[model samples]
Target: MLDIRRLHMLKTVAARGSITAAAQSLALSAGAVSQQLAALRHDVGVDLLRPDGRTVALTEAGRVLLEHADRILAAMEEAECAVAAVKGTVGATATLAALPSTVARIVAPALTALGTDHPQLAVTCLVTDQAQLRELTLGTVDVVLGQRYHHVPETMPKGIAVSPLLDDPLLVVTAADGSDERSFGLRELATHHLVVPPATTDCGQAILHACRQAGFTPTTRYVTADIAAQLALARSGLATALVPRTAIDPATPGISAAPIEDHPIQRLLFAATRRTETTNPTTAAVIAALGTAARQDHTTYLPPA
Candidate 1:
């Protein structure tokens, strides 16, 4: 079967005139350009180009192929635009990607509300972080719930639409049973065992920065990335950890979260759409519900750092 991508490549090469120029224009390796051109010639069963000293010029067959390719692609683009305007009342699929923590706490509730209201929409949740979430802005996934720390660069991907969904508090957690004092100063925490998040992660780095500001380094007992495991350690008297306040579950009833007196961390959450006029109706409905959930979620706001 003829490949559409190879046809597009042939069309591009013909328009650009030279293979070297086409490679540069397309940001593809010179070898890849040469291979695709050879494949395109074989696929069409014709000699498509003529060598003219250093540069190559398209023969009659190549010109004909280029014309056809351009017409086909333009027709496809028009079809996409036309169909995208239709409302998806019949049946549609929507995929939502979010961090593991956010998927459990925030996305689950929003998805529940959507499922109850819009029975035609099927929702699938994928666990991912901000970097992965940014990639889905290309329309790979219908909606993305991204979690970002305070100090991380305040950047939203261009060409994608976004809505702020929730603001979650990152807390300093310890054993509720062991500490008689409700609150502790910087000096008191320096003496305890800390199970810090991996130094590479945002949560771990934030806790490290707070300790440095307090004029001491935390003695880390374990280097772990899972906030749940860190919370478990803190509850079992193995170590104290910094975790999101919403992460505390009664099933793991040992750990207790207390807001830091010195530094309070708040995470920004955003819901994204590939484009405002996307074809997916389920995505549109989810976006509307998320806006409602975000406004209702405004029960308490943690102070920013």
Candidate 2:
């Protein structure tokens, strides 16, 4: 019989594209991962990988095995979840990866709700960037909280399930002491020194793309992914920023905020789960908690019509 653990290691190596990277992700040494792969190759009686200079390429047999490995691992995960469900047991760990924005606003409330309502289920949340989608698809994490820009939509990976949590609008942030009567228009915004997240980020891309659509490019003077830093700059008379409504802390002072007219840029905050793990009771509980927190956030922060 093929060793399940070794098969999983092979899958990780394949997903990561390198023995070293796979080892780091799995908390194993490169040598150890290599040994396991060698053992797995021997057991399968096939050449699963071939040397390609500093790296290795999956052999045809390796590709075939990888396909089966994904299914086998998913099936095993599903079986575990199913058995726990059938036993009516809720005590299990559900790992989640979330972007910084969601972590800032949604994680605490969601965790508190989970602790109160499903005490038996436990969660571990990681703050990550857009890379979490790959981890979710590989089953390294059970779920991911992510953002999708309306103008530049995120293409969902195959076999992942998404649940929308919030419709987050972008807000123009400037010094609270500045003219409250200042108008909002992408063209006007282009004239100012803009503070934005790194252009590589989805939020940053959304803001930049909207400005370009308005027939002008912003003069971005400050770039950082830290929401606090961006707001601080806006409050300090340094530059204006486009921020998500969900990322604003009500207690924070010194910043004036207004919704962009016509909603030129908006993002959908959503949670993604591996389709195979969708039935896991612990994962389901966590998703429910996230949904509840998001609903409350929208109610409290978003202006009522």
Candidate 3:
């Protein structure tokens, strides 16, 4: 019989595309992962992987086994969830991945609240973005806090469940005293030198699409993947940026934010989990806590209508 643990290692390896990367993500030494892969190959009597330049690539047999591994591992997780349900306890480590900006508003408070409310359930937070959606589907994380722009909707993969959390409106951040705290028209934004997140990201694409819809392309002078970097450029009077309200630092000394007037760009924030793991008591508890925290944040931080 194939070892379940080795099968899991193989799955992680395939997802990561390299033994070293899988080892780092799993907190195992590369040698340990290699040894497990070798044992798995012996048990299955097949060549599962082959060296590809500096990294490793999965073979046809490896791809087939990896598919089976997903089902087997999911079955094992369901079995554990079943046992935990019978015990009527929610005690296990649940890992959550989210974007950097969203973490401060919702995730941090949820962590504190979960500790007080359910001492037995431990939650680990990982900072990631939409680029890591595959990690969420592969079971690298128990849940993910992701955002979807109205202009650039994301297609959730099969077997994943999403819980709507909050609506984060995109705001314009400019040099202090440059624009009043009122909505500015998209035509006005076209005249400004913009510093935006890389267009490859969902947030960036949303901004570009919204601007185009208004009949002008923004003159993007700088592109960064970091929100803070975008804000810093805006604060220095070097560029203007469209940022999610959650990403704005009200205390920052030299920047002011305003909503876009005609083209209102907003992103929907949600928590995602594997469809099969939703029934796990620990997962349910954490999801509930996230909702509570998100509601609290909206009330405390968002401007009243």
Candidate 4:
């Protein structure tokens, strides 16, 4: 019989491209990982990995076994879900991964509600800049809160199901002057020194595309991934900034925000989970709690029409 744990280790090695990297990810020593792989190879009676300069490549046999391993692991998850359904309890540990902004604005409240409603379900949240989609496939995280910008098209991975949560509109933030907020056209941004996220980020790329579409490039005075820093620059009158509505706290002093009237840019926020695990009571509870929290905070976001 094939060892399920060894099969999982093989998948991790394949994903990481090296035994050492996989060992680090799994929190195991390289020698321990090597020993498990050797045992798996002996039991399977085939070479599963071949070293390719500085890394290991999966052999043809390894690829075949990987396919089976995926199915086996998925089936195991389904079995667990079914058992949980019968038990009628959400008593399981689940990890959720999301961007920093989402964690603060949406996930925090959702987790609080989840804790109150389902005390038996324990969840841990990991704050990340990127979605870490591969971690979902590896079963390292049970769910992910992700965003899709209007200008950037993202293809969801196979076996992952995404459910829309809200549409977060980008706003122009400037230092407050005690005047009524008024919308600004994209063309108006050409004259102001701007603070923006790095061009390599999804939000940055979308903002850049929107600016160019308005026929003039923005004069970016500051480039930073930290939304707080961007807002700080705007608050200090150093530069104006484009920020997602969710990243702004309405009560924050010194900064005023208004939507871009002529050309609106928004990012769709969604939650992603393994298709097979959706039926799990704990996963279902978490998704529901997030939805509830989002609706409660809907006044801050622009819902998709």
Candidate 5:
């Protein structure tokens, strides 16, 4: 029998036009993706992709196979749903996606509360750069806490039921002593060598656009894969950074966090659940916990940038 994993390769390649993107999506090396595609070609008896300079593009036959694969995946999901329904209990399993700021401050508290009171529920948190859609699309998780930056969005994704949580303040953090640096407006702020988040991350984009609007572009001296690294960067004074208020425990000294002059930056955290499971009790409990946590940020919450 042909491998289900190879079909996933075809689907991944289809979703992300380039093989490089597919590899990143699956967290696989380029060579690994190439091997999988080779297996996929052997199974299907056709040339599914071609090398076009740096990237691979899928052929017409590849696209056709992808459509069928999508149906198969959806049906498999439906079957899983049926099984899950039959095995239903008040508490099953839930996965959560959150930014590090929320994870440290609010999410941790809520999870603690849940664990103390409701131990039966299995909760796993995947905290990193935004990949909220993964929870909903792949059925990897039952809930997601997505960050909303800049002008608030008027709408949410179609299939998800959204509940607005709270606003997270993004602030500029630097050494307290003015000897090395002094407060500056947007233009100067942009040029300052900054410690940045990942390239495609929302926090990274927020800092970039806010700087551009204020008039200059940020020269990122360093970028971190994890939010926790920002503190060390700030401690060393190697680069200035914009971080969530909660991340910086206000009581912790050596750093002065100032609201970004003239530029307002806040993140709106939202609790998202699949609309199809409107009355999931476990989801309801999770939302309640999140609401309680948001109302009272255990960690010192900052004002907008």
Candidate 6:
């Protein structure tokens, strides 16, 4: 009979792209992982991996087995969840990974509500900007709160399920001291020093693309990855910034905000989970809490124009 644990190791190795990386994710030694794979290969009577430079590539047999492994693992998890459901308790631990901005406004509140509603289930939240889906496949996180710009292409990896949470509009932020009364368009911001996120980020790229489409490049004097910092600079009369509505508190003093008139842009916030864990009661409960938190009114912005 095949070992379920070995199958999981193979899946992790495939997801991580290298045995060493997979070992690191699994918190096991490379030699130990190799031994397990060797034993697995012996049982299957075939080579499952081939060296492709520094990384290992799955063989034809490995690919075929991986497909089966995915289904098997998912079914096993579903079975466990079913058993727990029958017991009248969902006593499980789940980890949630989310972006920093979403952590404060959405994740925090959702966690609070989740704790109140489901006392038996425990959840841990991780803030990250790296590869969230890869982490999900590696079992490092149970749920992911991620965002994508409207202009960017959506690439959903296999075996992951995504659900939309909210549409976060990008708004023009400036000082509230009533020094600037100009109706702001993407092009109009060329005259003022701008504060924007790093160009490498999706939000930054989208904002830059919108500005270039408006026939002028912004004179960016301040570049930061934090939306709060961007707002602070705008509030202090140092620069103007384009910030997401979810990150901005409408009542924040000394900051004026208005939606972009010429070229409107917004990012879609979504929650992702492994397809295998979708039926798990804990995962469902966390997603439900996130949905509830996202439904709150974070769109209210002061009309500063």
Instruction: In angstroms, give how far residue 118 of model 4 lies from its true place.
Output: 1.3
Query: Could you say which candidate leads in TM-score?
Result: 4
User: Looking at model 4, how many pairs of residues clash?
Assistant: 0
lDDT of 3 by residue, 248-287 (tens): 6566778888888888999998888887752888888888
Error of 3 at 162 (Å): 1.6
lDDT comparison, 1 vs 6, better candidate: 6
C-alpha RMSD by candidate, in order? 9.0, 2.3, 2.7, 2.5, 6.1, 2.6
What is the TM-score of candidate 6?
A: 0.89
User: Highest lDDT: which candidate?
Assistant: 4
Stretch of 10 with least lDDT, candidate 2: 177-186
Q: Better model by TM-score, 4 or 5? A: 4
> Per-candidate TM vs. native?
0.66, 0.93, 0.88, 0.96, 0.66, 0.89
lDDT of each: 0.68, 0.83, 0.84, 0.89, 0.72, 0.85
Q: What's the residue-level lDDT of 209 in candidate 6?
A: 90
lDDT of 6 by residue, 1-305 (tens): 99999999999999888999999988999999999999999989999999999899999999999999988888887788777667755566999998887876788889999889988778988887643878886678989999989988998877788889998888888889656544567778889899998899888999899988888888999999888789889989999999887777766889888778778888999999887543666777888899888886454434544
Give lDDT tens digits, candidate 4, residues 162-224: 888988889999999888878999999999999998999998999999999999999999999
Instruction: Report the candidate with higher lDDT, 3 versus 4.
Output: 4
| 253: Cα error in model 2, Å | 0.7
| Full candidate order by lDDT, most accurate first | 4, 6, 3, 2, 5, 1
Give the alpha carbon lDDT tens digit for every residue of 1-305 in model 2.
99999988888887788899899999999999999999998999989988777777899999999889888887888898788788765665788898877775788899988888878667888887674998987777887888899997469887788899989988888888745434477677867898998888988988888988888888999999888899899989899989888888865778887777753689998888888643777777788889988998888773211
- What C-alpha lDDT, on a 0 to 100 scale, does residue 294 get in candidate 2? 92
Give me the overall lDDT of model 3.
Answer: 0.84
